[model samples]
Target: MSTLSDYLNEHLPDGWQKPQLVEALSGTLDRATVYRYLAGSHPRSPAESVLEAFAKVLPGVTVVELRAAANLSAGAEEPWVPPVEANRLSHAQRRALESFIKATVGPIDDGDEPNHRQPSVDLQPAAPALTEQERAEVESYVQRLYASGRKDLADRVASSLVNNPSIEPATRPADA
Candidate 1:
């Protein structure tokens, strides 16, 4: 089984350092979290989130590698990138995806600055809320689904609640 530690050790070679890794790593990860993934001292196998973050910055690392490391790929074929045409991203969609990636993951140092031409975005603050009664009702629905041996249904409800764009993930109720 390939360990996350092995992946880190292999990738961080060629004079790579922790500070460089931290700066290069995308997502909301902190320095302490990076330290927790150190390969030199007390390395921890990265969680799915850590692996996903690594995928954004590290070349040749992707969802395939993530699954492989977890032994979930089940003898998968060699990794490959889909052709641009295969992706079917329209010109507008491509630009929008580039903009979103730059905003979230920053630049990839591919020898040039990003085009920086994108459609304007209307930033809006969403304050989604569910009344106590509504929360209780949802919770009851989930529990009933689980009790009836329909955990998949309960998980779907919980996933929808957690993934709703209107609600901030941090503000979700504990039961959700």
Candidate 2:
């Protein structure tokens, strides 16, 4: 169970240091960022762009392998599926589930009473719709992927945007 850092150190090119690797990445990432990732101290998962850049500079490394090394699932290509239990939930059942979850986890704001006030469970709000400009930005990024000869990736991105209607693009204002 070697960690990603171990793999990177073992396969580093002769005479290459962290600074050299940063330079090889064309400064898209900094030495400290690279070190943090290698040290597994990053607060969040490394962005796909960062992983792709590392794959480009590191010999015999692929983005898939890098993702796996970071403990990410390799089956991102699989179709999305809702849980069977989720698909069968009625409105009452859903409410019951939400109540159960809230009861188990307690409330987000417990500082007010500490033990006196009952835990409050609020329903999460719907996600905001993407503005026209944001839609254009995503389209532009997908186009760039196509231009870079990564049509498969471009298609996947496009498909994800289309399939997830909660993030549908908003209609522009008439005056604007």
- TM-scores for all candidates: the values are 0.34, 0.41
Query: Which run of 10 residues does model 2 get worst, by summed lDDT?
Result: 117-126
Kindly state the number of residue pairs that clash in model 2. Answer: 0
Model 2 pairs whose backbones collide: none
Shift of residue 72 alpha carbon in model 2, Å = 0.3
| lDDT computed for candidate 2 | 0.53
lDDT of 1 at 46: 38
Candidate 2 ranges beyond 4 A from true positions: 75-176
lDDT of candidate 1?
Answer: 0.47
TM-score of decoy 2: 0.41
Q: In model 2, what is the error at residue 92, expressed in angstroms?
A: 23
